[model samples]
Target: MVLKKLVRYIINKYLKDYIEQLDYEKLKLDLKNGHVCLENLHLKPEALTDLSLPVTVATGCLEKFTLIIPWKNLYSMPTKVQIDGFYMLIVPKNGK
Candidate 1:
């Protein structure tokens, strides 16, 4: 049905714009609360500041696996969403 396709297109567009601040690839929308949630979403790693390290050393670091950033920090960061009082909740994706 044409309506189905249109709805898909709208949701997809909304997702693309929403996740621009996040490094996640997948998301789901909760229509009841108008909340978009991404499981196991990774806050993008800090930009590489130096390139001198060998590839093996880079991959072996634990920071690559997990970061200790706080939940409050995420809500403070800028996002494309302009609505007032937008909120966020970050839990370990799949209890990681």
Candidate 2:
């Protein structure tokens, strides 16, 4: 259940109320590669309680750690928070 704990910890720390309706088929954490992959990820629109909450909440989470999207922004989100063990690389579908 370590994976579950890890996933929950990350979600709770970053996602907050959005977790209730977050949909993803898999949570794959590769320790050796220092990456977390959330496959088939999407959010159910109806579950969102507040529209502005997501925007501000997102900034809050990003403030805490380095966010890598597209796998191309990897080198930019400040190396201080980009600790290999702390960041998550959210490689969006087809690199979109």
Candidate lDDT (C-alpha), each: 0.34, 0.39
Residue 34, model 2, lDDT? 50
Q: What is the per-residue lDDT of model 2 for residues 1-96, given as tens digits with 9 covering 90 to 100?
A: 675576557755765453334443454554444555543333333323364333222211121223233333447653122422322232222222
RMSD of candidate 2 to true structure, Å: 12.9
Among residues 3 or more apart in sequence or in different chains, the pairs in candidate 1 whose N, CA or C atoms overlap within 3 Å are 40-93
Local error of candidate 1 at residue 84 (angstroms): 22
TM-score, every prediction: 0.23, 0.36
Residue 53's C-alpha lDDT in candidate 1?
Answer: 27
Index of the highest-lDDT prediction: 2
Q: After superposition, how far is residue 20 of candidate 1 from its true place, in Å?
A: 9.9
